[model samples]
Target chain A: MGSAMGVLLDIAGVLYEGDRPIPGAVDAVRRLRGSGLAVRYLTNSTRRPKRRIVERLRSLGFPVDPAEILTPAEAACDWLRREGYAPHLLIHPDLEEDFMDLPKSDRIAVVVGDAGPCFSYERMNAAFRELERGAPFLALAINRVFKDRDGKLSLDAGAFVKALEYSSGTPALLLGKPSRDFFVAGARSMGCALGDVTMIGDDAESDVSGAIAAGVRAAIHVQTGKYRAGDETQHDHRPSALARDIAAAVDLLVETD
Target chain B: MGSAMGVLLDIAGVLYEGDRPIPGAVDAVRRLRGSGLAVRYLTNSTRRPKRRIVERLRSLGFPVDPAEILTPAEAACDWLRREGYAPHLLIHPDLEEDFMDLPKSDRIAVVVGDAGPCFSYERMNAAFRELERGAPFLALAINRVFKDRDGKLSLDAGAFVKALEYSSGTPALLLGKPSRDFFVAGARSMGCALGDVTMIGDDAESDVSGAIAAGVRAAIHVQTGKYRAGDETQHDHRPSALARDIAAAVDLLVETD
Candidate 1:
């Protein structure tokens, strides 16, 4: 086949939920390796940096690398730079490394990054107060909900973003998946056409559906991360293949690259 | 006309932004007296305590009693009681005032509140570790974003909750909008049928659309807080009446009431 056969993977539900590996996740990656194809992992996960995502995968016995991973946060930083900040005041934990030692300001604000539950009323009051002064709301990833390894669903940055949009009546600029920009960026960086790629993961809406819309020929949805057996209806568009585990996804894909 | 014809008001966007009153908000409320109808300030604001909301409105020159206000937080608390909470962690400024007085949790982990741009990385790390244990991602009000009178937007506690959800892959229980329990509580407290009441608000989706979905027919949209000219198309369901400002909203509804 063409370079279009390159594989893209999602780790959370695909490889492992936590320390425990998914049923077929490990063999899936090993099998993809047996076919001798390039693999990439992409996730909308906004938690730990790429290093942790990789480390966690290795701990779970899945063949993964930090370089192979692309998170919405990384895309968020890139997206922010493409549209230069007005010295935006950030509301995130430890953004210093990401902001590259830029000075902080209370004057200008752009709502970016993860909204940890550690968020305070004082924080809410401060932001609300700032919004009252007319600052723009720029959210990193507007995902309303996210699921953890144990397969429990919870609110994500998007839910809070929606809340603010409703409360303040301010429009937000979303920079992550389903937005189309990140999808395009990943493709450009890969230096490949859309045909050569397969987005494999648990989330059908963001990863698979977004990849499909971005022109990927195939998207393999693994029931590994937040996706459970009964959540088929949650996806607006169906995946090219459905595998019980990650290894099954690799087997499902026709090796080309 | 019945009492249903009277003015059903919305608090946040129409009357104020942040802790300060909107420029013409108090004046508009005073003028509502001429309409010869009772002004009931209905709010979907879930963040603040009821007494605080009432106090804030009273300080802004509008006469408001505790009964005149309806918040999703109260409704959520009620729901929590009905459903049950096992000693959960809290991340708000004033826990005793918000949750401790209500029903208590057994296995609480983190208790956070507003401390500003100073959200430490250490704090976030600790929260993640506890939540990794899979305690419920609990919150009081899920509204994180806010607009000041000048319209500057910023993230609040809801955003923090969102961040945690993304990191740990857990969902939160919103004590506010989209929760039918809250609306039912509001109607119950008001001792009115959910359909007979009218909700006047400026937010296109959250307030107006929420009210309509809750069976309120008359919703007034104003360009005061989150309302702008371009907001007309954000939601398919528009308000029953459109007002340029709260003054206009009162002017139109006063006669009918």
Candidate 2:
């Protein structure tokens, strides 16, 4: 039983996509559930409301509590507020709703993302126009690309953010991934201090380093996610443990400690 | 006024996006009208039908006769056919019509582009299956990023192509941009030989060098468009001629010789 050491789950690739479950993903979740680990479904599904994310996960055979589903949108809104960046931002147009809690202004923050086609000239113009008028550019995650549905890759938000960086010469704040605050927020939202938590995920950049930065006692990296490029010799390396899959992740946690 | 040397206009940043027009860009085409220059919009608009492109350009401001538009799509399809790569496998999902002219089945030469979100496991699976079945990976432009309407840049087709590159360790046969055939296609559209022409455009990598590769007598780098880094030193350190704007471009031609 993993009740003593908690586990966090990543949704998209680890859980399900749209309606179909990834191969063997449910069994992995069930195995974790059977172990009694506190399962938090951490997701960057800013596109969907939290309810949908939870409902979808439940439908896919995962037991997810409403309070347990975490999203970057929430962290983004929180980070914006905490940092005192003016609320009204020309955020990625795709994430207009993410900023619903933030105050709005006619002027916009500088626009950037490898996020999607959302980086269109219209979105860039809106962000650039606001930035041109003295709005600061606060960008989200800057990963070069995101692994797509088919487990292949495409440029992610970072590429677009860098494009604006080259164009505007303004550096935006990063809210998620490798940013300490995201892990801090995750723990804070879980109503626990980072020192008490055991964090595990597939990405070293976001999971391990981020957890470490926020003071998580331990971090486990699963080789299956973004880090399928998982050579520890690469830059940004170092985790308490590494595993090929979720099952391996739980084993690493048990074995390492 | 431009018809004298036989105009060799570059596409990409110069003319259209996908199959659409850049804002206020119709003016360039309108200006080209009756300018007495043998005008041809030479493009690397890979994955598009030139006929459709001509129609799109006319709606945007080009007096482009469909016959006047030179595309990598045509050249690629042509190359595929001649090399007996006919009906070559197309990796890109967007412009299948471009390949329709090719010999059907068993002759599919290669697949191309970054394939976007569709570059999914399924898409890559399909490409790999074909490649496993002996299809080559053919690419059009391998641009790393493209500017959105917002002026922020996002991933280009290169990222997807790269994954396939990683997966197969096979380089793609590029069919557009810096390729020599691209420049030759431009001149061919103008009814001129490469050595007799001058190449003009914004992107130094794809346009200037491509012009040089095609044996263009000269190239002028415009600072306003694609290669505008706000700092010229970072780009191709040497431009045959540098102009800050289009008017400056015209002035450079007048003053140079």
Candidate 3:
């Protein structure tokens, strides 16, 4: 395969895990950027707005600009604007700032994210009502579970999305990771062709397998964050390379180039 | 075909639509009981305990005894006792009374029901933790939607059950309607063979098709609550007879005998 012209870097596990940056993650991004490769931050995290995510990255000493980050919330906003539909958001309260610029209209869509403790029955019912009334259902991501702040696996937005789908008898349009369009969007944002972009992340399924399925040049799986011992073998589309962490993945990319 | 020797009656739609009884439903039950057929009430409702359910039936002028009512809550309790596990109940607060008598232990099983307003992320995550730790997942019912008090379709326990299953990568054991074992238990309670008991209800899929699949003698579909036009055509197992309402279903049952 050809070398990567651009890179899609997963934010949470690859850079930091629960408020602490992975060893050498900050220097790795700088070295990769110094190599003249276009880099874009892509994340499935739905709990925070893009600004807050950028701020978090900055706090950890990563040289990231707000424009360099791409989130599902931004993609969802673009889709909402393109479709001329207003959203009834079932999302975490912290993420509300991303969709503030969308025009309000009577044609509504149900947008679901990881609402965390905000996933109340009343909120779910409200979203269900919107879907039942023929509103479009847009899900940010459908990852089944995520490592919670307490270091335990907890239900993610995907589970709640499945619930709403079951209740309303309506299928949801995915706007985040594992969606080919999401990876393509990331590639497009950096003016890179799908075949010239590589993804680096810890999640084997959504980050590695998803990028491979999306026609990226390669995906480097990192053994950090939520990576389990046998996670790499779980999906049919395996990662192109395995790295100890993002720093190791950067070394492979830089040395290969 | 042989005539029905006993009956399994669905509570919500067949007997009443919301708080109002279907026309002649009370008299129909009286006539059916007078015909010497063993009768049992089967419901999937997990919002209330058996005592409250019986109270509501009495308030509606139905001659329902608590001993004649069969609910998934009771079934779940029985199963928990048999398996020697204490339940970590993710159910409506109103239904806690039903499980209060069970012995408490660390061998916890996650029991999910229609929690209505009680479905919060904290509760769902707690249940997920139990499931992740090798706890058995028991769902009271998995009906997709239910007609709410507002006369609008709302999400039922099935939606939440699906969410937990998606998150934990575990299949749940069903303890309510549409579970063949549930129907068999209803028949067994009435001292009748499965082939000698008929089911009467409005839900084409759960009440009618479910009983048919369970090998009941017959299932009478009534056109009342939640019975949309062409519902019978939606399922592969057609009801033995279609009646305008529960009263008509009773007339058909009594006359055939």
Candidate 4:
């Protein structure tokens, strides 16, 4: 692969996993930045606002700025503004801060995320009612399952999104991972063309395959965070290369450059 | 069409809607029975137990025996007993009385129904965890939406069933409407062959199309309850006949005979 001008990095499982930073990830990120590549921290996490995510990254000894992070919530807000729609949010309470500044309007859109314990029949019905009233539906991410804090696979927002889609008969506009627009937005934020950027992450489907399908120059599959053995073989879109971790992935990229 | 020996009738839209019974439904059911056809009230309702449903029907002046109603919950219990699997039920609280008599065993099956307000994230995750452990997944119904008591379409158990199926990557064994086994079971309960039975209901997909797909002698789509003007034309399996209501459906059957 040719030298990339920018890199998109997945946070959870790539840099850190649940309050603990991956070994050598902090140094790897610093070294990669020193090599003069424009970098963006991309995540599908909807449980926290971008502020909290940046704070968490900083607390883990990685140099992160609020401006350097890209989230589906932010992307959704941007889209909502462009479309002149006010969101009737069905999202986690902790993540509500992200949408607090948006302009309120009568033109409503149902926005769904992982509401955690707040997912109830009444709430889901309320969102369904909105969609039935012809409101556009927006989903942050539609990944089926996620590794919960308890280390067991649990239902993610994608399942709830699917439920609303089934009930309302309206296809939700995806604003998060695995969507080509999300990847392109991340690349655009870094001031690079989609074909001049590389992506590194542990998740085969969302991070690697998503970037590859979005026309990224290359996507490196890293065996860290949520990655199981042979995950690379599960999807139709193969990653450009497989690395032991983000540090090794950085090494391969820098060496080629 | 050949004269039918048995009839499977959907309760909500065909016999009644919400608290009020459909006009002429009482006389229609009685007149159909007087014609010497065995009648079974088949419903996908998981919100209430069979006893309560029978009581409601009787109170509305429809002569109904508890034995005449065949609910998906009852069907599921029978399947659980036959398979020797104990149920880990995620059902409406009012419906729990129906499954109270099942034998306890170590082998567990996750049975999902319309739990109303009881569908919390913790409970859904618990069910997902059970499914992850290799337990059989059973769904009482998978109907996308239903006309609520408030007369608005609401999310039904089918959406939640899809959620679990997506998260666990396990297909649920449907024990309600649209499943061939549920229709066949209703016919067998009256000791009639599938070809000797006819179905009548307002729901085009679940009631009429489902019965037709299961090879019933005929299915009459009644234009009442949740039935919209163009519902009969929505699916490929068109109803054998379209009637204004249950009374008209019975009139057509008796006149043909």
Best-performing candidate as measured by DockQ: 3
Q: What docking grade applies to model 1?
A: incorrect
Off by over 4 Å in 3: none
Candidates 3 and 4, the one with greater lDDT: 3
DockQ of 4: 0.82
Model 1 chain A is weakest, by summed lDDT over 10 consecutive residues, at A96-105
TM-score of 3: 0.96
DockQ for each model: 0.15, 0.05, 0.91, 0.82
Model with the higher DockQ, candidate 2 or 4: 4
Docking class of 2: incorrect
Stretches off by above 4 angstroms in model 1 are A1-4, A20-27, A55-67, A86-96, A101-111, A121-138, A149-151, A168-171, A254-257, B1-257
Candidate 3 per-residue lDDT over residues B1-257, each given as its tens digit: 33689999999878887899888999899989988889999999999999998998899989888989999999999999999999999999999999999977779999999999999999999999999899999999998888888888789999999999988888999999999999999999898899999999888878999889989999999998878789898887999999999888888878644
Q: Estimate, for each residue in A81-139, the C-alpha lDDT of model 4 and write its tens digit.
A: 99999999999999999999999788999999989888988899899999999999999
Query: What is the C-alpha lDDT profile of model 2 across A131-227, one tens digit per residue?
Result: 5456777666655444666566444555445545544446677765556676666666656666766776765656676667667777777666456
**Global Cα RMSD, each model:** 7.5, 8.0, 1.9, 2.0
For the record, the alpha-carbon RMSD of candidate 4 to the native fold, in angstroms, is 2.0
Q: Would you list the C-alpha lDDT of every candidate in the order shown?
A: 0.61, 0.59, 0.91, 0.89
Q: Rank the candidates by DockQ, best first.
A: 3, 4, 1, 2
Kindly list the per-residue Cα lDDT of model 2 for residues B1-257, writing each as its tens digit: 23235556766566655455655456544554435456666665544566666666677666767677676677777777777776434344556677676665455555665343344433444554455455777777666555545565454565455545544446678787777777776777777787766667776666776567667767767665456464334444345677665545555444333
Which lDDT tens digits does candidate 1 get at residues B111-188? 333323544444544565567676655454444444544455455455555556655656766555434455555555
Task: Name the weakest run of 10 consecutive residues (lDDT summed) in model 4 chain B.
Answer: B248-257
Candidate 3: docking tier? high
